[model samples]
Target: MFRHAFRRFPLRVFGLVALAFVMANILGGLIGTALAATIGLAVFLPLFLFKILMVLMFFRFLMSFVGGYGPRRPCSRGRIKDRLQEPPAEPTKEETEWREHVRLARKELDELFPDAEQFIE
Candidate 1:
């Protein structure tokens, strides 16, 4: 769908949006070239680092959010202590059998090549 729009109405969709966004800053009437420089830097740096497509999509999502800022939330909600404090679960029967097989393989490997780094344990 977007590929089609990119082929079709680029100016109607993104081109004019970008143009208007830049021009709005240019014509904000007070900031002058400072705002223009900031806008130019934002565009050029993101294009250089992350490439044009990702930067454009980021700007599109930014424009979609109210006042161009999403709602704030904590970076992470969970307490690491909770998980660390929990006891590990017992291994299942299948896991036990798998471990036995691994142990046997390691034993064989040790017998065959004692100098090996021994990965199984």
Candidate 2:
């Protein structure tokens, strides 16, 4: 098991290196080659990504306060009331099973108390 994990470790490392290189190239392309070279790709890449995330989150927070009803809550768009008014075409299998279970429970309770009227009183 240890050997298997070790074997795949190099492949995972290689993938990470490739990803870093790609991100560095993207950073270099967007923000100029000189800046990328000065800051160094390894250190700057994660910081730059974190800054972007923070800026986006800050803007989202600001918008929530600025707006009227920040975002619309999801609601039932269909005629749910009408659907409820209309009876189900047929009792579902689960519903049938539930009814059967309830019946059995009631029967067991009746057996426990032979006189139902005395228990109610």
Candidate 3:
């Protein structure tokens, strides 16, 4: 019965069915490739970002040490420490105010808990 019905259809129907199958296969393959690419990006993108960030951090570390502000090593004779330890700079107004605040806070704490000192240290 199906062959009889199929015979009633023109040969164009067979060609159309074949073309539809080919189009569907092509579409499926394209979708599969897109999904695979999406998955690859999802897996590798963060690793790539982390690699870039690590490179940036390494450069920052190198740059930080490039200036004279980085940590210094002692000289063979150990006089580097002595030479580097110059007289302290004069305190600014903010420093003086901070010191006064700390002194008052300490005095108040001492008055509040004279016996607390025994527990300290």
Candidate 4:
């Protein structure tokens, strides 16, 4: 449903809000790289990634309380489904049977009372 609306956050739509966990943590790498260059701690790659990870952890923890409003509201799923995918136009089994029965009964009545139409004048 929400697959196309938010293509970037597709995984998050399926109720698994923790998929791209490292997304917010990538900053740790940036911090580590900055520190390495400034202080000659030059271990940029590994340590920077780790710093980004810790930052991600902290941010994720904070964001856990903040589930933003998605493209579709929770209450709107049922209503949208109901409106979009309606039943086919063909008659129901019971309705078809009832209509057939009425046709037959009218035919019988016409045959039994053919003269009834003439007396109407």
Candidate 5:
């Protein structure tokens, strides 16, 4: 649906709508707070929260259309073969050393405080 619009209409419309949505929410929140204080906080709080939530959802929707601010690329279909073709990344020396240190510490802890393990469980 959006892809069709992107093809037909200028992309600027989407950007403008997103910006307007954000500005409206900000102004609405400020006005709502003033109204709530004069009338009652209870009514204003929910309205404020709702407007904020709507703005957040609108921003997320806009981000999806914006391609995360990068060059848009067509998505590719995939299978397990694609995953298998990529080699696994190797662990760094620091990571290996950290794991070994943890193992040794655990071993020492087990010997030094068997009761500690029982308490943890």
Candidate 6:
């Protein structure tokens, strides 16, 4: 289903995001508390906001990458798999005959024309 569509690339990305989220939340809390005690609320507030943004972004990115669980199927209107799998059309018999005729005509012209030196004008 989604397993074939997504592959392992997105799963690896989700794992990395989750790791970053954990690290940021833990470190940001510790660092934010210390900075507030020393530098005050003005600087600490921005740092806190930045940490919150990072957490939210990481979760959003992770969820978007996660694969769906279900049977594999295309849209209701048409089968995407069939559309992708279809082979290109081969030339029709008429087209093939036309190409062959053109080749024979070119050969005949070359024989008749021979060389420019052989021609009078």
Error of 5 at 34 (Å): 42
lDDT score, candidate 1, position 49: 71
Comparing 3 and 4 on TM-score, the stronger one: 3
| Clash pairs for candidate 5 | none
Predicted structure 1, TM vs. truth = 0.31
Task: Tell me the tens digit of each residue's lDDT in model 4 across 1-121.
Answer: 6767678576556445444446445677788878778776555667988999999888766665554323344335576678679877899899999999999998999999988887887
Q: Candidate 2 — which pairs collide?
A: none
Go through the candidates in order and give each one's C-alpha lDDT: 0.74, 0.80, 0.83, 0.72, 0.78, 0.78
The alpha-carbon deviation from the true structure for residue 34 of candidate 1, after best TM-score superposition, in angstroms, is 52
Query: Best lDDT goes to which candidate?
Result: 3
- Model 3 lDDT per residue over 25-82, tens place: 9999999999999999999999999999999888766756554322453332355566
Tens digits of per-residue lDDT for model 2, 17-117? 99999999898797887776777977888999999999988877666664332354122333455677887789889999999999999999889887885
lDDT of 5 by residue, 20-100 (tens): 999999999999988878787677788999999999888766765653422342222243456668898799999999999
- In terms of lDDT, model 3 sits at 0.83
Tens digit of per-residue lDDT, candidate 6, span 1-121: 7877579878889899999999999999999998877788777789999999999888766655444222332343246667767897899999999999999998898888878446756
- How many clashing residue pairs are found in candidate 1? 0
TM-score of candidate 5 on Cα atoms, chains taken together: 0.35
TM-scores of the candidates are 0.31, 0.32, 0.50, 0.26, 0.35, 0.25
For candidate 1, write residues 57-114 as lDDT tens digits: 7876775564433344222234345566789889999999999999999899789988
Off by over 4 Å in 1: 1-79, 115-121
Question: Candidate 3 — number of clashing residue pairs?
Answer: 0
Best by TM-score: 3
Over 4 Å off, model 3: 1-10, 68-121
Q: Where is model 5 more than 4 Å wrong at Cα?
A: 1-63, 66-69, 72-85
> Model 4 shows how many backbone clashes?
6
